[model samples]
Target: MPNPSTPEFAVVCRFQGLFPKDIGGYEKHRTRNGGDLGHVDPTRSHLNRPVIGKADWAARTIALIEDMKAENFADEIETLTRRRRKKQIKERMAEGPRDPWRATRHGPMREVILTANRDWFDALPTAAAREARAQAFEDAARDWLLENFGGDVVHARADLDEQAFHIHAVIVPKVQVELNGTKRWMLQPSKHELIKDYEAAQDSVGAHFAPLGLKRGERRAEAVRKARQAGEEPPAYRQHVRTADWRKAEDTRIVETRAELDRRTEAVTAEEVALEQKQEAVTGREKAIGAREDAAMAKEKEAGAVLAVGQGLAAGALDIEDRDGTPALIETPEAKSGLLSKLRARMARSSSGRARALHVFSKALARLREKARDEAKTAVARDTAEIQSADETIVEIASRLPYAERRSIGKIRVSLSARIMALTGRDTSRKTPAKGEDDESP
Candidate 1:
């Protein structure tokens, strides 16, 4: 009873499930004239009466049930429904534990109980006055039940012999539900729950008697909601129970749960702090990387600006790769400074006589290609360091040549177009010197 609590004087309306088989015994208990009623005081047992029903509880219940069955044609529908369920159970057996109707049974009809605490009645001046006030409470509760549950409410009776005046009712709700496109009637108590959700059901009985100044008791739901919103550990729910042992056990459980909640909240706080610090560290690293990228781009811009100003890069493509030892058609669009500086140093190193001899060697390379044009490839192992050195010298001379001749000039020749073919040993890269542009004699 953590929710829908009734104050000591307020109305307490509650419903319980009553299965079809248990109806007979319950009807006997409600309609009994004077046999041993468990919680009833033997001296006041005669005080119980059918305050709201047309007859005794059992007789009224039987009449209403008959009327409902005849009006809704329940027998034929129940027969067909059973046959279909049986067929389905048989057909789905191959699916093992997945049969839909395997454990399915009928839900119980509704048995509602409404009452107030005995202290309110005791505080009254006279027994007659208590009876009148109890009558008022009973009338209001009966009216509320009839209004909500309609003709489905079978019987209502008053028990004055109990600790407090209370009303007992049985409502067998005949609900219309559609299954597989066909609509039919069934006794289902849960339909009332759909009509009024849990919280509203709890509020209804108390609100009906609000003019009497009686109030609903406190519950834990609202407090739990606020706690979650504030990011705090919620308080454990404490159920209202009568037995001392049950209440003590629930209290113990709540205490243990509160301790567990506090521990979990502290751990979550620590994790959030660690996560925040990690995110800050990652942000710092990203900023450092961005700064380095910005610096590299700025350096490239400064060097390219100087090259554009000093060299005639805007006028022609400057051959940058040939000035380095690597023979390539690549130009220095941004690194023209490196190419200009390196070429000046290397050309200054070559003597005048040496430059002339290197120029003659370049002419000799062209003649070699012409001579080997028709010669068949021979298996020759060569060590051509002098040829490679001569190739470098020719590149220095080509720096002074025009752009087309510069591209066509160097990567000077070896002896013949004999590719390196080592059949026994490990083979190296083919170093066959290519034919020059002027020696295309084929």
Candidate 2:
């Protein structure tokens, strides 16, 4: 039998700063019995204690969900949503009798999530080596946080030894004093939000440090000021100084190198802006030409259809006069009775020996009219199909273009139906198709 795969290791890190005022009463109402909230376990202890005593954990998790919804962090939500059932402790307390001290006991706190793939690191460095690496990463991470977020890092600890190598940190923001001398930590809106910003900043600064073999947070402020005076962007200034430090004998070379890089970056940014403006101009002109082509095509088809119908009507080939003074144009039950009248008029106008000729001719006229109507209907159908095919082509073309220039030409069904109706002899004052009607090309 194959050896079982190593069981996945799990680690958790949490921080507790303060408790709310009505926390004790809430715990009493929350627990099956009076006990420390953090010591309870349903699987073994079951003494009415919570696995995590910090009520702020439940509150902050809810706040994280709201923030995720605002920032549209959909990738992280699956992990967050699964933990909702574990968050029912707050709901259970809210059902209890009102307590005046609830707000005091349930204050805000910082929360962060960090994890590593333990399987990759299972080659196992010595304890001393692992600690050194962890400390180095932590120090690098902290320096990044201070520069961007302005906070004093308070604590860092691993969650689990066997499974995942992860750290949890608690940071107190720089204290700001009021005009009256009261002081408080500058509020961090969300722990997850802060952690993400820190991670992104580190990635940016760390990548810059790696190629030159320079450690992060090493460049002095004076070098940056001089480079800035020479018109370097902040990141480029630091890069130049770090590269010079690595070379150690090239002070003169560093100045010229930094100046050249800055010039190149400015040129690239200007080129990109110009290209975007030119693209926009080209798109605008193409759209104008397309709109004109569509209008002309529609107008041309309309003129052809009118010409076909007018020629047919002028020939009087389908027109019939009835003996009862009725025209064969009106379509109704009363008008259909005039069909017999139309037949009698034909016989009266026929030769005396050719009485049956009128009946034969009347039948032939009915057949001819039906044929003409069918042909007209088929012509409209063919045009409709062509129009629909054209619409699909337009959509396919627009999809490949950039978003700002991808103007909608409307749906093939609605627009094609309207255009086809206009080309044929039908009303098109509505947007939706008639019930049970297939949307074909014009």
Candidate 3:
């Protein structure tokens, strides 16, 4: 027997295909209730009630059904009827059931309602607190569907104005799956699969809410099985058979658990705030380091440019002319002296002697130019070596910084991921990278 006071987590699923005549009745039940025009105080009726205005019924309802369109699930069936004879059969099937008033071949949709015991919300002191709790439960439940059903949930609404706060989620059972190496869509899920999925979701919801002092309640089927295993007589009303003494004991345990949970929640909230502050400080420091690195790189580039200009000037092939402010060639002292001697010898000889002197002067100038080029190449190589050595020293100094500084980068990434998981209640391990993300390792 389970205590009534302890919150019970329950998930109920039902498949529905509305017939022509049933459509009006179903719509009336969901939107309005009681007599034809609907009751003003419909909440008083235990059977049907007015839905909470805050519930996102339109959005939730849309989520449940939009995926079950014919285009998505009709491929497999359509492929089988590609031949002429089979095409005829497909046309007949498209005509639908002989009874026009009934549902189509795949039916309309399925409804899943996830709920917690009334005591869960009743225990909350404020309406705001209760609403937050309800919203959290609904979000968890929606995530459960997305995980197991591959995003089949189309519509979902939470009704707070009813007897209990519960979520009504509509789901299209269709899913794309790989079978025998072939990918195809399935329209219906097996009963075994649905039951197993529900059980898993039940466990998930229990774990998610445990930190808030909501424990998992025993199910009647599970209780009966345990009783049979122990060779004990099962109670007549297995679902509602908690004794006074058991209830009292469970209530005491819950109170103690709630107190502990509150303390832990407060501690965790404080820790989260501190972690966020640390993360921000780390980010600021990283940005400052990046700026310093950029400045250093800019200085290195400037030094390289200056070295190139100096090498060009030293080569004597480049000279800054004051008149035009442009580079002009400059002759070495030896070359200038040799040219003057050739000019003097040209006047003391025949035309052939003058030609010979002119050739000698040109040879001297060529040799001087070649010598200047060699000196420029040597200087460039030396400067490059020195620059490489400086780079290595800088890298070594960076690596030798305190271990805490190096570890801060990794810690920031880990903490950011943890915070995201805490807020969303999502498993970080299962998250898929967005499109265009590289799959290669760093």
Predicted structure with the largest lDDT when compared to the true one: 1
The lowest-lDDT stretch of 10 consecutive residues in candidate 1 is 95-104
Q: Estimate the TM-score of every prediction.
A: 0.43, 0.21, 0.36
lDDT of 3 at 355: 35
**In model 3, which range of ten residues has the least summed lDDT?**
433-442
lDDT of each: 0.59, 0.44, 0.51
Q: Could you give me the TM-score of model 1 versus the true structure? A: 0.43
lDDT for model 2, on a 0 to 1 scale? 0.44
TM-score winner among the candidates? 1
TM-score of 2: 0.21
Local accuracy of candidate 3 as per-residue lDDT tens digits, 64-145: 2333334333543454455445875667578642321123543434555666667776777998897788677766666655
lDDT of 3 at 391: 41
Residue 375 shift from truth in candidate 1, angstroms = 99
Compose the digit string of candidate 2's lDDT tens values, residues 1-442: 3225634322222223322333343334244255332323434333222222244543443343344333332222333355553454355335432211114222343333233344423434686666555455445444444454453343334433224444444443323323223222233323434343433433455453333232233334555666789997654422222111334446457778888989998999899889999988999999999999987765555444433323333444334435563233312333344553543344334233132333444455668888999998998889768766775666566566554445333354456566677878677785443333233311
